[model samples]
Target: MIASVGLVRYAKCVLFGASTPRPEPDSGKVDFSAAAAAEVSVPADFRCPISLELMKDPVVVASGQTYDRESISHWIASGHATCPKTGQALAHQNLVPNKALKNLISLWCREENIPFDVTESEPNAVTANKAATEAARMTASFLVETLAASKETDAANRIVHELRQLATSGSDVRSFIGGAGGIPLLVPLLSSSEPNLQLNAVTALLNLSVLEANKKRIMHADGAIDGIVCVLSSGATWRARENAAAAVVSLSGVHSYRRRLGRDRRIVAELVNLVNVGPISTRKYSLDALASLAGDRENIRRLVESGVIKVALEAVEDADSADEAVAVLAALAKRGGAPELGVQEGVVRKLVRVLKNGSDSGRANAASALVYLCRKAGGGNLVAELAVVPGVEWVIWEMMASGTERGRRKAAALGRICRRWAVAAEADRLAARYSDVSLTVASSTRMAVAQ
Candidate 1:
């Protein structure tokens, strides 16, 4: 054990080009100070060549290359006979535990204040379901600690990337990350100038928010929503912005969270911007978040006020976003924003076009929005205008014929409004024409009588 500690100090000296006096074996503890541990980088040999992460359990295969036990086991299980690093064919598929290296890594982790349980790292330990869960929990705790202590941008980026991966693994692991206090640490990195760090941090939050408990934890964390909004508005990469929007969608799943997000005009504006200008996937995510926000009545007003109607109108023309855009419009209309939505230039026309030629969902939502507009006070004029659109009547007929039950109901209602408004408009036109003929005849009779 003294020799192993000596080896660790020598390896650190070689890697970091600094030296410290060897610890006395009688002390039974490594003499490295916390300051020294903070400065000591992980030795190259201590990291698994495959994962490039500190090895929890080091193992050697036939080619004499050391890798993390879990990593090498996965490699062999994938039917690869050759060593990953050397590409040399394995004479046998056996992995020998490098107990000395494992001990060195353990001592190094202890000195660095990183949690690494040797028992958890054993291959047989992971075979049991409970052991695997515990191992994930410990791993999450270690990652959270590393992320919190890391000052180097590159190191922080790598740790966050790993946290993102772990958060995505399963709901249990996501719960573990939240329990490990990873949410607060990740919230600050959402605004990181390092592009990868910001991207990974926001994405990890998105993954963590999949669990209901983590969603509350994330929202309650200070500056969490602000950090996410900053990323959504001006992130370093489009993917970062996209993931930030996705995080909003995840958080907006809760009613209270949705209302809180909806209160932020910046959040609504950014979502509208993304719906207007982002790529297909980004637009989809932004629209999804907007849809959730629109569930609140006040949010619907904010969305409409943020020029979302124009964005949705433009998006309705896109086959990729037609359904989502129309869904948002439907939500807005259903939530008392019908007057605002109905007044937008070309909105009715665009919705009619969607009803005629868009996807099933788009058509249904368009139908719903139109029905809402026609039900508002003084909506007969709007209905009259809709009835004149060339294909709207046929579209309504088709919806009633082949649409879902809800679609059929909306279509039937719209059809009745159109027919009623059309009849009323004709009656008004006839009344004006009749009055005109009477005036003309009266003028003729007066002129004849005066002559």
Candidate 2:
């Protein structure tokens, strides 16, 4: 644990840049205390232009601009494509790590006794836990004071780094943070123009959102929804999109919050776009958010209007995401605006496929969706034959009507299902054939021949 702590501190410091907040030395204090000069003085060339800290892992940007590697990475990740100092278009953005500068900084810190207490380790769990709690309590207080005391982005950056570190510790740390006024402090940072702050703020919130108490508090926080929506609106950075989506997904699990989340069309649009084209993990989070929001019938209307059902059709065909896609479809399938679009996009075939070759839970969801579709078709509205799957409605209806009350379950076997073939056989417009041949469901002529 001690070794890991040192590595993290080293990594955090390596993000040094000149653009960061630097505390100006007080000339009055310098004159009064001669030792202050010795404490503050460092070789000028050793500092990063962006952070003004002695560089740990220095690197050169494409514009011949030298900066710490982590700092430059944060800059580029915030959607900067050009040099921060020169404003010149970079032919490419790359950081070539400077090993010589790193070694020099290590040697310098060693000589200055800077590594004297990088981490406090007592090797006793109880003692370590107390120390960590005290540190977290103090750090949380510092953040509250900093935000209230000054309007400095750099200072905020440093505070957010600690918030992120604490967040990564575990849910217990996150609970500690929520009690320390971390959620409210973290909410405003999501609107920050600083990419690094926005990244960590959202990450910290996400880590805490696993607690239902934090989720409710965060949802009601001022500027929270708008801040998250703004991040989703930014198509530029993966950090913003990924973490913001994750935060939304976490907060969205609370049943009461679904209506408010679904009411935001921009968020809904962004989620839809993400599903159709975002990174794989982003797609999963986005889909989960949409599915939860689909709890509201009006939100389901919006999702259908966004043509998500078609995207869902495509998503269902993929093995990795099939269950998640099915979950979303099931959520939306029972609503008015969703059914026609789903059927138009060949959802019947997809649902049947899910029913045939899905896990018990997946199959139940698919079967429920199929039943909902059946009810929609049979519900006083005349749906065109081509607009619906030919015999799936008949199949689902039969299973429900004749499914026995035996042992609290029925239709667990195809034999029970075959007995209900008589229902399909008796209908004049339908042609149902059953044999002892195979146990597959043939909802249409094509399916039967394929079987």
Candidate 3:
């Protein structure tokens, strides 16, 4: 049976141009050319061993020394190379060469004096030497076609289609718009009553506006900024607000819009008002935009003075718990402007109150803000006194026993506060004995439940 099987294999190889003489069973010599030719003959072997394609998105085979489109392609097709021998999936870190393919390539390269270049961007050494100019030309042509397709009147139902086309077109969309004549194509869609149409148009514009040319178009279109602001200002659907926020975020990135957001002041006031009165979704988006702008120190100071901080504080006071307020507070704390605005001006006190009594999220953000404020407030006795308010300690202990990640993060933050507030020994002991505390807390809570 073994002899018959070997004869059948030899017959198939012969049909496929395998020209080497079959070795006797005792022959130790390996036949390189015949094996290489046989491996190459099966186009399936030529398919990407990873993706199983004809070397599309090719990766180096695990043996780490060869370059055969066929072998790599085969590995992809067979799915044997997905997980390593130990069963760990082929993550980005475990990449190695396909030994057979590498040996073949090295043999071919040695014979032909060709160097293999296999960087990710140059995965196919055979194709790597192709002219960049030629590739760019093809890419530009693709973008032009896709840009045309995306402009179809019914872009609403075709968003996925448009997105795929846009992505494939590469970066030319921005470069082309930066040159000239693209704004006219993108502006009208902003006013479309159809939410999806407006969303796609705004998104496309946001993408294209990254370049100088499209930004000029935005300013040239007298109503583009107003239209975006209107969408943001209105109680449009969440998707619309998200799109509007994205576009606004993009426009705000342009120097042309900087004055509009800052010196001109109208846009800032409107955005702040949205933070106070817009729907919860709209408010979130508005605050996100504000947070982005506040990266500029002047903008941060302006927000502190805008009365929005008080409004946010009041909202936290009014919430059933503090989750809704935490995101905003975390952003403010991250900006580190509390001292300049005066923590003693009531924000700090209220935040400490929230840290002691607010919901898990609120306490976390408030705790974070307190840490920043204490450092900024010069880490004096006043801060320590505030840190250990009876109420705050009670809340911290309660949160340390909670199950949520936010609860845990809050508890950790509180522990840091305890250490900083001259309770370092206690905090250290607690850290060293966390397991005991956890068990005690669990048992006591359960017994309390039984009682």
- Provide C-alpha RMSD values for all models, in order: 18.4, 19.0, 21.3
Superposed model 3: Cα runs more than 4 Å off: 1-180, 192-197, 209-223, 235-238, 251-260, 314-368, 375-385, 390-451
TM-score, cand. 2 vs. native: 0.57
lDDT of 2 by residue, 352-449 (tens): 77765664435545664654564564522212321244564454445455432220122233223333443443652343334322334434656868
Error of 1 at 317 (Å): 2.7
Q: Write the per-residue lDDT of candidate 1 for residues 1-451, one digit (tens) a residue.
A: 4334334433443344222222111211111112334235556457554433467778878755678787688667746686554234577878889898899988878877877777746443222356566666667777788778888877777677667766644566778889999999999998888776777788778768766789899989999989988998998777778777777766775678889999999999998888877777678768867877887777777787798878877888887788778878888888888888777777788888889887655677788889998786258667877988987888899999997545677789999988888788899999999999999999999999999
Clashes (N, CA, C under 3 Å) per candidate: 0, 6, 22
Give the higher-lDDT candidate: 2 or 3: 2
Cα lDDT tens digits for candidate 3, 1-451: 4334334433443343222222122111111212233223223233331111122223343322122344334334535443211111233323344455544544554455544444333333212333432343333344344445554545332432233223222234345433434445556666777555555566556555544445567767867766776666552355455445545544554433644565435556776776676555445445545654554445656666676566566656655424445445555555766665344456656777776666544565676666666666565644666665667666666767772444466567756666666666567678879978899999999999999
C-alpha lDDT score of every prediction, in listed order: 0.73, 0.58, 0.49
Sorting all predicted structures by lDDT, with the top scorer first, yields 1, 2, 3
lDDT of 2: 0.58
